[model samples]
Target: MKKKTKIIISVVAFVVAAIVTTGYIIISGMQKNLDNLKSIESNDVDLSKISDGTYSGSYKVLPISVEVSVTVKDHKITAIDLLKHDNGKGKAAETIINDVIKADSLKVDAVTGATYSSKVILLAIEDALSIATETNNK
Candidate 1:
């Protein structure tokens, strides 16, 4: 083969290998993140044990993350503010906060189309309330 043809072929092969490697890494990370999210189980927190105050928490599962501020008053979840949410096609999952406030619990159903996002949000809320529970226990 001509020297120029060999060089061109080598470059093309290198580019293909780079692309394939990058794709594999991304897919692998995504699969691992999904598995982590699936394994997340929101803990049952006792609201009555939580004091009246606002607490902050966050949960991240690559490509999806949530930060929440939960307000408790008279042992009830008065409100939930989503400080930050990084999601793909899960914007609708924000409404899950309302369901949580209404139920005053973390056992609410995940949003239909945004189940992953919903779970992350719930976990963040749980994280925040868990702090309160811990504080009260001390």
Candidate 2:
């Protein structure tokens, strides 16, 4: 009976260790992904080059992801729609879109506390605009 009890304890300990290790790895990966966002700079897309149409773009970084639809008219941004925003405590970053539209460029500042999400949002906008720029260049 004592041997059986010891085996059970050993198994539980091993299981706990495995769980802890997995959690640590996951947390480390997430931190690395977030850190990578610090160096990501959004390109200033020339709206004049983009045709009059709606473009869709998406960007993901671990805990934060964004999908945006940007509508341009007469070489100007008319509207921006955030179709999907998956974030943890980064909802304030949504206002960053307004800054982009107001500035007519992606070089606007990020939200105060939601910097990671702000960068991700800007990157997604850049991705969408790039499609238009590429199409026009071709």
Winning model by TM-score: 2
Error of 1 at 3 (Å): 1.7
Candidate 1 clash total? 0
- Per-candidate TM equals 0.91, 0.96
Alpha-carbon runs more than 4 Å astray in model 2: none
Model 2 per-residue lDDT at 110? 91
Candidate 1 residue runs with Cα over 4 Å from true position: none
Q: Report, for every candidate in turn, its global Cα lDDT versus the true structure.
A: 0.92, 0.92
For candidate 1, give the lDDT of residue 78: 96
lDDT of 2 at 120: 95
Residue 30 lDDT in candidate 2? 92
Model 1: colliding residue pairs: none
TM-score for candidate 2: 0.96
Q: Which lDDT tens digits does candidate 1 get at residues 17-55?
A: 999999999989987997878887998799889999999
Candidate 2's C-alpha lDDT? 0.92
The ten-residue window of minimal lDDT in model 2 covers: 128-137
